[model samples]
Target: MVQNLTKRASPHNVNDRKEVLSGSCIEATASEIIQESNENMTVADAVAQMFENLGVKSAYGVSGGAMASLWGALSNSDIDVLNFRHEAGAAFAATEGYFASGNPTVVFTTAGPGITNALTGLFAARGEGAKVILLSACTSAPQRGRWAIQETSTDTLPSSGIFTTGTVFNYASTVESAAQLPQIFRKLAVGMSQPGGYVAHLTIPTAVQNMLMDETQLPEQGVSCSLVTADAQVVGNVAKLLRSGTFAIWLGFGARGAASEIRQLAEKTGAAVMCSPRGKGIFPENHPQFIGVTGLGGHGSVMTYMQEQAPVRTLVLGSRLSEPTSFWNQEMVPSEGFIHVDVDANVPGVAYPHAETIGIVSDVKAFVLQLLDILEAEEISESQLKASQPSSLPKPERSPVEAGSESLIRPEILMEAIQKVIVDGTDAVVMAECGNSFTWSTNLLRFSQANRYRVSTGVGAMGHAVTGVVGAAQARDGIAVAIVGDGAMLMNNEISTAVKYQIPAIWIVLNDARYNMCHQGMKMLGMTGADAIIPETNFEMIARGMGAKGIRVTKESEITAALETAIAANGPIIIDVLIDPDRPAPSKGRNKGLASQGVKSTSEQKPKVQASFPNI
Candidate 1:
């Protein structure tokens, strides 16, 4: 029963209600609302129950003095409480959880340094458009402004004033009273219902967390996850624009959920298809309609056609056309205007200028479904539709490794080997980290299903998959494979978390003995650099020491067998493959930026590598 919290709880202290709820240092509301409950429950129980109602399966973070009791409560619940080695790694795991489960996962942190440690992962989550719940505790009310142990300024509570910078989080607030719980959920409902990535920061003082409250007072469902469809007029206009032109389809990570409709649209219109690096698997890279990827690890087939041969208008789907996706090159933009469809209204026409821009604010799946219907209704002729197909374009080629070095395996060979296990053998989740990991996987790996291929390209954070794969593995039935560079693996301690849980995660570490992407870029630019050369460490030995299986692959022949062995193992396995550091870094078209600097190279000498390592 929803009892009035404004009412006093007992005869001895009947005036207690006035002291607590009547302008009593609590965050006030306009009117009286559900403020109290009949059952006795602690603040920790209320918060944990909120997560339960929100369908959270796992909560990741480290236990600290300020938030230990809350972590204790979560441990007794059905949701798994994973104590990560670091707050940032835990937050990254939560971000991956959102991607795998289609629901926001929770990340807990203590006050001060704990909250600050989580900022990088929070930034990556927002950049990737993932939904996550960040819970932290502040110093007790008496400790504020007194330089209490590990106390940060309570004037803002959770942040030092950074969550509001640019687009770090969708919503943030501090809970002052039990009466504000419902209102906080109400705000979360609004943020979750809106399209795009959302991070909600909710901080509670240590004292407020110990307060007694009623369990019935909190709503079971905190977020309104209703299906939002596209506008009929907007989808119809897009269908009309897409039908007649010699246009191509550009796939974004957002289009993964609408794969069937995307294929239907492409078939009906006979359009060419290219995907953003993060969008690889949505349209089936092996399909004839799919030409190549765009950006750092992208191919020249799509870009060359866009520049020299094709009279194409692009149907940009669910992409913001971020700098990496477009390479900030004006030539990639279609001569004719692009018909951009994204759920977020602010995402359209922000990256590249088009001749004409048609913006449609709607969900990717809904828009594709509506567009398919409109295409069938129009009944356009086959020849006209076929005209939209590419005219005798060369198919993408994968050059074989012929460096004749029996010592180090080529990156291409490694990607092909990993692809066999993920695509051919089992239905595993393949994640590519940024840098050469992103480039090799984008260029060499093949994905055909939704949510099968994952990456964080927007923030371009290194070591994302190193920790992010833990949650991804937990959410999936099969194994989660993380292809990471040695440089990225050295960044975090998520391997310990995976080992602790014995989760079926496989880490494919490309041991290049350095930050090969940067090292190669400097050499290619004819400049000397420092600290780019890192000593090769035995990652397999590290995993073994942490209680997980490990394998080291040297020759090309050992690649597939070692991966096979790792897959058949019981727990997390690290396959450290020594890749040829002498191989040119796979840049896709990122080296185009270096052309103006008078760095000329023949096809054989050009370094096909670009640096995309975002700050950790």
Candidate 2:
């Protein structure tokens, strides 16, 4: 099935080949090309070009001999190739980069442990709804099960989910021949063109990567796919349901693109809006109609609104309403049911299956726009909407800081500085790692714009933000800050990677010398004899050692100055703040959820200070 090309009048006329032989008969077959015609065009190069055509601007991973060809191909292309210290860090960074720039990114690994190490971040990408592709090396057919160096084969790795189209990836395959490029490219192009996130994997054997590919085998640059939208029947049904009774809107990360439409809908119907932790900025948090955030690190104002207003129906836009978002709290459920809209059809009734749900599979933006259209056509008056609105909506409140010069800084004071100096004062993207960092930031900070805040509520990995900030900063070509705890900072960080690339990323380390969340949660659960303490290591010293700027903040008053300095710096910087470990984060809801799940508290010693926020 090999095809050959003859000398043409021009190189561009030879099936659009950028490199073609002049005044020579091209005698190479599809599998093998003459050196004079497609000079040095390997299958790896073709794959890299295909990715570039698909709009991939960056590739991040650790390079090895097995993937030397791909590394060279990607390096030579216009895409920025970043050599990372660890494969997991690269994958995490790729995930954040896709979210920051709205462009799919690539994670390359050699084989075996390199591929395995990237699984965690890849899973996080899937959970957080990011488009990422993993390109890795695998053992050739001749070397299969023969104990090749860094062997990657079916004998060593399970192929069910990793190498096949299953839960882990929307599409997965092994590139055994160059001829498969057309189908692979089509699938990827279609997947990337569709709504929502799409994660894929393509494993190419080291030997096969060097094979020559015909120009006809290369995939086209792009594909066109229609947006997923609700049909008129579904839209009409949903509008009727919302019009029948009082309904509120629940926003999630998936609804980020429809911010303006969501605002219009909320204002038109006078419905209260609540969002998940990851969906913080999708709707303006400062708006009067915004009740509060829901789930872990959420506000009591949301619960207060639910109890007082007691909407008959809830319009859930793109939220999964999972444990972290709702804790599956029966109190939050409306009397009538939920009119849930999402791109994935399965997400509708899964979280709260017992409750009645009318699911509509459509892109959040398209669905919201259609709903607004229906409302507009109905000519719903502003006066009628005002009659249904609540007298006064509950607002989230936080306890006032004492403003003392304590030896250790308060988390509230640190968050206040972040709110003023970074969140509001600048356009830097802010991300909070899991544990106490997420709780403190989500519970305190307020966002007025979409895509300014990021948190991994799906996997909730510890080192995600620590390593991901680098990718975000590089992709956006601006300042990206990570609010991380000491344990996460010590576990995994890309200070060296950021320094290497000179990306202007910032890390604010809450140096409490302990896994404070674990320590505090264990105490709250009445667990005894648990060790969550870590040695106090100066993160500023670590950052400085890695050839990046560093600053240490020991007092609350020093936080603002340190942040201002870090933001002003042109390169990576770490602000190590000695935070008070005794102050409890707002995690009572999570503790209560754990208790209900049969986790019994065994000790009598309770947390000394319980951080409480009033429901305004």
lDDT of each: 0.75, 0.85
Determine which window of 10 residues in candidate 1 has minimal summed lDDT: 1-10
lDDT of 2 by residue, 312-402 (tens): 8899998899877987777778998888989998899999989999999999999889988887888888667656668579888677777
TM-score list, all predictions: 0.88, 0.91
TM-score of 1: 0.88
lDDT of 1 by residue, 284-316 (tens): 777877778877777767666676656557888
Off by over 4 Å in 1: 1-38, 154-166, 214-216, 222-230, 403-405, 592-616
Error of 2 at 511 (Å): 0.7
RMSD to the hidden true structure, all candidates: 8.0, 6.2
Which RMSD does model 2 reach against the true structure? 6.2
